[model samples]
Target: MIPLYLLHITTVEHSESLLWTFLTCNVFVVTAGIVFMYKLFTQKKVRGAGIVFGIAIAINYILIAIFGDPFDLLG
Candidate 1:
């Protein structure tokens, strides 16, 4: 809700669809951080870190990979 709250604070009239937009972004980031940190703490290989980071980035862009647009922030 940071983006929406910030936008709200800034008083910009963002599309109402921003509720989902922010949710998706938060889920992507939180999942990545949790999974990556888990693997980092559990795994021994240095590659684990790399893979985690890559997956984190990939998760954020998975929509673009499949849907074409970067993020459907509006709708």
Candidate 2:
């Protein structure tokens, strides 16, 4: 999904891509993590929740900078 946004950014004729990057990454992380957290909550492995959350956030920001807007989007 993040890659898809990047590809979209490339073909979209110079517009802001950061918004999309942040939106897609965070939304996916939060949504997937919520389900994962709920499932693992039953197992009492609460620590796994923090680790997963951190990983998700880390990856998103990495991708965000890699695929962020090129300043031309402001036009």
Candidate 3:
């Protein structure tokens, strides 16, 4: 997420293309996380750091979608 923000900042000059870039990144991360979680679940080992990390990422993405960017609201 930090890296995505950094890329967003660096690509400010290309705002038109940034939309697609950001969307693609979001899709990729969420999809990968889901796949990882599913694999872990099926193996009967759904405990530990990987699950926690995936849940955290999923929650963050959900909140962002629900509330809009907190940073954006400040302005």
Q: Give RMSD (Å) of candidate 3 vs. truth.
A: 8.9
Worst 10 residues of 1 by lDDT: 6-15
Best first by TM-score, ranked: 2, 1, 3
lDDT of 3 by residue, 10-44 (tens): 32333445555555656666676676678677885
Worst 10 residues of 2 by lDDT: 6-15
The per-residue C-alpha lDDT of model 3 at residue 30 equals: 64
In candidate 2, how many Å is residue 44 off? 8.3
lDDT of 3: 0.54
Q: In candidate 1, what are the lDDT values of residues 1-75, reduced to their tens digit?
A: 575554223233345575456456556666767767777788755476667667766654663344433333332
Question: Candidate 3 versus the native: TM-score?
Answer: 0.41
Cα error of candidate 1 at position 48, Å? 6.8
RMSD of each: 6.8, 7.6, 8.9
RMSD of 1: 6.8
State each candidate's clash count.
0, 0, 0
Give the top-scoring candidate (lDDT).
2
- Expressed as tens digits, the lDDT of each residue in 1-75 for candidate 2 is 565554334433324566665566677788768967786867766676667777887787566446654442332
Candidate 2 wrong stretches, greater than 4 Å: 1-15, 44-54, 63-75
TM-score, cand. 1 vs. native = 0.43
State model 2's lDDT: 0.61
